[model samples]
Target: MKKILSFFSYVFHPMFISVYAVLLYFFLTDRYHSYQELFLIMIQIIILTILIPISMFYFLMTLGKANSLMLSEITQRKIPLAINAFLLYILITQSIREEVIPELYFFFFGALASTIITFLLIFVNLKASIHMIGISSITIFIIGFSLHTQVNHIYLVATFLLLTGIVATSRLSMKAHDGKELIAGFLVGVLPQIGLLSFWL
Candidate 1:
């Protein structure tokens, strides 16, 4: 049981959420994007969102500024979140332009807003569940994508809803977050996505 819970935590870690969102966006959209274009976009996402963050994490770990990938401490979250926000800003402004792919563009925009909010909460010594934030943000984005594209992605939505509960439980079991932090993370994750729906959806 412990191993399984830990597995979900790592599998749904915040660092990989952007890649998941982009993959899902491509999966569900009927729009035609060339294989080369999709491959390049994916490569960009992997480099910026995953590879860069992992490298930064190792650097911070070497400096004794971060101990783990989970970033279990509020103090540890500051730098990573700030870097993530900057990366997301670059992704939206330079790579995924709104005119090119409005859905993904707005998705990153919402993610940036959520990252900034989470970063701000750290000053007050509040540690919301970043796991919850990641899962919830992607879940709501999936929901919004379904509505906007008029695709019957009910099964996908249901799967993520289930994953959301599993992730919340996983965090609780790991003692990484209390109920309030999880709820706060959920709100922080969803509100921006919901608010930005008008621009794309």
Candidate 2:
């Protein structure tokens, strides 16, 4: 049971959530461009959000700057979160400037905003669960997408809800966070995206 929970935590690590959400959004939405263009976008997001950050985390670990890949320590989160805020700022600005998937810019922006808020919250000595933040962010994005398109993605919504529960359970089972931290993480992850929903509509 412990191993299974750990596997899910690793597979759905916070670092990979944004890319996964972007990938799903691209595939699920219409594409007027060629397959190559779509592939290129996916590659860009994967590298920017996943590959680079993962490599950076590993390097930070090697340098004793980060305690673990999980970022279980509050102090360890500062540099990585700061780097993520910077990178996400660049990616979203570039995407908007290029007018590529302009409609989806809010999702990326919401993620960036959430990261910034999370980074700032570290100063107050709060260590909310990043796992919950990642899952909830994606969940809110999917919900927003459904509302924007006037389509019922009930299944997708339900799937993420289940995933949210799983993530919360795993975090608790690992003794990484208390219920209060979990709730705060979910709110911090979701509220930014919800606030940006009006721009999309």
Highest lDDT: which candidate? 1
The digit string of per-residue lDDT tens for model 1 on 1-201 reads 978988999999988898899889888998998889889999999999999999999999999999998898789999999999999999999999999999999988998999999999998888988899899999999999889889889999999999999999999999999999999999999899899999998
**RMSD of each predicted structure:** 0.8, 1.6
- With a 3 Å backbone cut-off (N, CA, C), the pairs that clash in candidate 1 are none
Q: Enumerate clash totals for all models, in the order shown.
A: 0, 0
> Judged by TM-score, which candidate is best?
1
| TM-score against truth, every candidate | 0.98, 0.93
Deviation in Å, model 1, residue 106 alpha carbon: 0.6
The parts of candidate 2 lying over 4 Å away from their true place are 96-98
